[model samples]
Target: MNKELLEKGFIPDEICKVLPEGFQDIEEIASSLHKILANNQITNAVNEITQEKDLSKLTNSELERAMLLYSYVGHAYMWGKEEVEDTIPENIAVTWYEISEKLDRPPILSYASYALNNWALLDESKPLSLDNIRILQNFLSGVDEDWFIMIHVAIEYEAKNVLGSLKKYYLDEDFENKNLEDALTSIKKINEIMNRMPEKCDPYIYYNRVRPYIFGWKNNPATPKGVIYKGVEKYKDEPQLFRGETGAQSSIVPALDALLGITHSNDPLREYLDEMRIYMPSEHRGLLAGLDKFLEEGPKNKVVEHETFVNEIIGEVHKFRNKHLEYAKDYIFDQALKKQSNSNIVGTGGTPFMKYLDKHLKETVPKDD
Candidate 1:
């Protein structure tokens, strides 16, 4: 397992090859990514996943699949098994319970479901209901110490934020004061619980698991931007928004396959078991132990290798990003900077400044030495 390769060091090249039209500064953009990875604490999280898995059993062809899977596992629970469908909260809680029961672990299913039910109060599709709001508030206030607290705390925090937004949006509309008070109180209680947990104990498992979807908190442009109000009497109702493209699964599958490429030996079962452990929760340590028995037989056919798969996929995506980056550099960034000149950016355009910065970066930082 080459660390630099796994870290997407070759993405820029892939981008350059795929989208040649507007990718002049692709190396520069790639350099910026390297800088971000070096600076951000998230690098530790990425490294942890990489170090834990021994990807020896995967074949060269399977490498892309493994890498894609690694990416997918990060958001497996958030996205549905299929595309464009939201993972229903009730369904997830039920799935967790079933998984837990199979392993003889006590259930923490109801807690997550409860949180989701509360979050639904803020769902823009339907009007906010007072009963749902009160129920959510009461549910949060009651939670103190439970096995589900780890997930519950995060969910409750999210619920509070949603409920707050609802109040803000519908200030003119009459809602129950009791519901608001209860929600506020619950929010404080959740904060207290979160404060007591260890630094490693992140309650936001939902967010972590659904990292890709949650990261880009933007509305899909393909859908209508929702209803707009004009003047005092005119309210234009927009067409209902439906998300057609959620690319999480496709993106993650290739990455996971890349890692799976490394497992080619006579006995790959051990390697497969080792790879799966990274995605397992801390409470399911025994599950990993049980999986050890299954890895006795190694992979039958050596399908792929990690390096080649990663490079290929990186190459493909690099093309896509380079196309966008070229558009940004040649058109959008400069236009944006110029029109908003009174704003932060200062220069003839964005590229020249970024180009200077890129040269400085290449000189100052040795290339992954």
Candidate 2:
């Protein structure tokens, strides 16, 4: 029953950061998205590329790489205009949808395409810290945008140790308190990295530049009906609503919650968290669900006796969630009130977050004594 996670944690191994020669046309434009959008060339430049390239011919990693490029290109084209675009043009729409189908996720940008699979190492020999990392693609690149996503990337990198500890605690027969101890240590480290979010990613720059491009058509005042995929037949030319990329989609928190026996009330926030599950990679979803199921079926005596460890986990989660709520207010909610309408006050993930984040933080209590 000892199930081991991948060396890279929930992140994909050997992600295709760069597509191959056949995709040179798309790759070139994707690399310069920030510049292209500034010059107002995204629409015409994107429209010119045909969708003759075959996706089935691509490897899974390449398909992921394609998704990364197409997502950046799609978001840039849609949000880049001085005026908002209600319809995704045929060229971007058709190709992006195809890639989405292959990846089995929505056509719009998600966390995987945005941060999980969207990084490169400045020195592969070194560790995956911010010093060694560089974002592969960006809409309007800046310290704010780079730090926002890179902070996420850093947190994801740190979560591997958390997952490693959980794997041992769940599957290893001799699962020890050391596993829980290590998990809490990693959990604390995760919060530490998160607290540094404001260092370079200022609230104003994040709101005006980074946050704008990630908003999905769903629940958005700018594109309330969502975006119409002009040529994707499944929609029949209707507006399709998808949530924007949010940190909730990351597998790390869900895994930690499952490990610590944390549960949320059956409410809108819980429902929204489930909705974000669809956007996660299938294997990562299995990890969250399977870990929860494993706990329900496995003997509880081992973990129950360690009330002290459980309290430590709860406290760490509380710390992380509290910091998250603060970031939500400073980085998005307050900023939205100043610049955006009521609809956009929702989280970048396309859901009301203020009340939910607070509720989730309080719900991070210890298991019944």
Please report, in order, the local distance difference test score of every candidate based on alpha carbons.
0.28, 0.83
lDDT by residue (tens digit), candidate 2, 51-121: 76778788988998998888888888888988997998887788889988888888988999899998888
TM-score for model 1?
A: 0.18
Off by over 4 Å in 2: 1-3, 6-8, 295-299, 340-344
Which candidate leads in lDDT?
Answer: 2
Q: Which regions of candidate 1 deviate over 4 angstroms?
A: 1-153, 156-172, 199-369
lDDT (C-alpha) at residue 142 in model 1: 24
Candidate 1: minimum summed lDDT over ten consecutive residues — where?
Answer: 10-19
Estimated TM-score for each candidate: 0.18, 0.95
